[model samples]
Target: MRIALLTEGVHPYAQRAGGGWCRRLVEGLAEHEFQLHLLAGDGGGSGGGGGAGEGPATYGPATYELAMWGRRPAGRGPAAHRRRAYVRAYRELVRALVLPGERGSFASGLYRLAELTRQDGALPAFLASGHAQRVLEREWRAPGADTAAGQPLVRDVLVAGDLLEQCLRPLSAPWYGPGPGRLGAVDLCHVVGGGPAALPALVAKRLHGVPFVVTEHGLHLREQYRSYRSAPYRWPVRALLLSFFRLLTEETYREAAVLTPGSAYDQQWQQRCGADPARTRVVHEGTEAVGREAAGVEPEQPVLVWAGALEPGRDADLMLHAYARVRAELPGARLLVYGEESAPGYLDHCKAIAERLELGEGVRFAGLPESTAQAWAAGTVVVFTGLTQRSPRLLADAMLSGRAVISTEVGVAREVVGPSGLLVPPRDPAALAGACLALLRDEERRARFGLAGRLRAQERFAVAPVVTAFREIYLELVSHWPAFPAVDGADGGVPRPFARPAEYWVAGAMAEAH
Candidate 1:
């Protein structure tokens, strides 16, 4: 079967983003063909020498076809006709955002803009125009509009417009409508993330009767809410943008053939955001089992390892406080932080906190390790202090390495840890310290927990089973998808033979053979 894997700001080229997961899926299912429809972010720039259809060299050999679509160029300005159409369509879209009852108008306006984009190819210019700003202002100030009370300023409108332009740019891509080497030809469209990444897949399903599946590793709406809450924009601007995201998610959830959340925590978020419970499934991220030798080794010191990017979400400061308490009880205890810095200045801040606490040699930032096994081997206990997480890969690695894990109660951490590891209340350094101390003081208990963790990882989080589940989902979707009618004589009838059950094909083949 051929699959179109849709992604934004990830895959085919990105080194750290969701690229690794996409690469794994494509590589694991070698029997099927994959076409990567990548919607490049601001940093992604234009497509390389591979052009639009061929995979880039960064992704290695030609296992899958790659189509790169980038952000609209800033230089090209829209013409008078296109600008007028953009204004009308954008006005309608904003109205739908403010008034939930106008969802049909929202879909209509969205597609109208898509149509104009196809004809004029100047969506970027339209979004940059003063007319777009006027349209947003009018909608925000409209009577009964939720944002009317906030009274947005000119700067807020401009910033919001810029953000909206980026989000809606996917509609202008050539891959949306019917054509060769586009979404219309794929057997299934599997979106790797939510929000804007799933927009094209939504269009493909609506326009061509294709079945699209959404696999969300993180809840896009929750991430957006967190980001926009702290944004510099005014309340009105934030409200407008958030409303747009909420609407997008609602529509995507309603239309998707299946919603695959990486964990039950993520599944709950999806359902809360209006996803049908019948269409949702929890598919855990796959983790490769560690070698027995690596799992069996004992560390030379009583080391606590925290392995993840140094970001605000990781709450490294809380970890430091907990370690300080642990050191008071166990002076020989060491904390090994093994990961690259994700947020600017976060690593320096963590180091400063450790120094202030006089944890000189007690704490060490080991940066990136040569291997996950090596990192886990350097520590007796694995710790996670993140305030929020969605089936973190690091925790799975720690469990697979047969280490006793001490994690804050967060997204699926408790569920994943089960009885194999200890869970502490998030943001409470005292609780975190107590948990770590408990595991450190009892070597026998630690060994038992480690063994249970190793067994759990092998049984539930192993790569083979997760990959097999996805393969089955793809086959099931393809077999039941509504077939589109043939446009000409060369085109076959609607509900193509591929959509028929395997038994039908096998029976026909047997009769032919006889």
Candidate 2:
């Protein structure tokens, strides 16, 4: 079967992000024809050095890359009549954005704009034009629009217009059409990421009869909300762009044939975003399971392992403070931090924090581990201190390695840890320290937790089960393909699945006869 895998970010194309699960999915299902659609660089944050490792050593031939900020080629510009429609569409789109009462116009306005872009092919130019800014200004100043916070200045309108154009670029992509080698020809459109990455899949399903599956490892809309809080945009720009993302994500969730959240935590977010409970599935992100032999051997010292990128959100400071308390009680206890700095100078910042806490030789920064098993084997208990960790792959790796875990009660920690380990509230050093001390003091408890954790990882998070689930999902969606509701004009209606009988009355009759 032909499958189109749409994703956002530099994963698979770059060595960053641990080779990414996309590569694994494609490799696991090598018998099927897979086409990759990647959107690079979306979060408009400024950072130095390409962050992590070099480009991927082997990017498959099926990959298609599009940069979020790539320049659009100059067009002769749309005809005069078409220009008016573009202006009206932009007006409606911005209207839906700024006014809460007009939220229902979002989907209609969005697809109308997409149709205009698909027909004329100058969406970026149109968005960057003065016309787009005027629409945004008028919408903001319109009656019922929420301008009580503050009126948007000229610069704010321009910035918001540019952002909107960048996000909507996928709608103008040439990947659609019913011809072979295009998205329409694919047996299924699988969106590997949420938000803008799903934009292409949305377009494909809208233009063609193809069904799309959305697999969300993290809640993209939630991430957008958090990121925009720290973003350098003005309030007006933030408000407008956030609304666009909010509405777009909701439309994606509502339209998806199936919503596969990487964990139960993310599944809740999907439902809150309007995903149908009957259509939603929780698929845990998988990792290679470590052998029992590797997990059975414990480190001699009472060591605590913290593995993750050394970024501000990871709250390394809290971990240091908690470890300081642990050292006071058990002077022999050690804290080993593994992984490199994701945000520049975060490593030095953590080191300075350790100094302030006066955690002498008890705390040590070990660079990236050669392998996950080695990292988990180097310590008796694994620790996580992030304020927000969506997938928490290292937590799974620790469980797979048969090591006891103590994680912040965030993201998938509760679901992943279950009864195998301990959980502490985020940013609470006293609670974290208490949990660590409890585990370190009791070797029997740690051993029992480790064994249980290993078993849980093997049963739940192993790669084979995850692949099998998708294999079945793909077939299930395609098996009922031709029943997809026909796409209505520009303002596409929500596609409904073919109805199934609530009760198998025919089979019931057969059973009654028997």
Query: What is the overall TM-score of model 1 with all chains considered together?
Result: 0.84
How well is each residue in 1-514 modelled by candidate 2, as lDDT tens digits?
Answer: 7788887764221222323588778778887787776666642221111122232445452555555654543555566888899888888888888899988888888888778888878777888887777888888888778653878898887777777877887777666665434676666888877878788888877777678999877777887887787678888787887788899999998889999998888888888888899999998888755444545577788999998888988998889999999999999999999988978999999999899888888888999989877888899899999898787577887888888999999878899889999999999999999999999999999989988988888888778888999998887777655543333322154322231222444567889999
lDDT of 1 by residue, 436-460 (tens): 9999999999999999998887777
How far in Å is the alpha carbon of 23 misplaced in model 1? 2.0
CA lDDT, every prediction?
A: 0.77, 0.78
Question: How many pairs of residues collide in each model?
Answer: 0, 0
Q: What is the lDDT of residue 262 in candidate 1?
A: 88
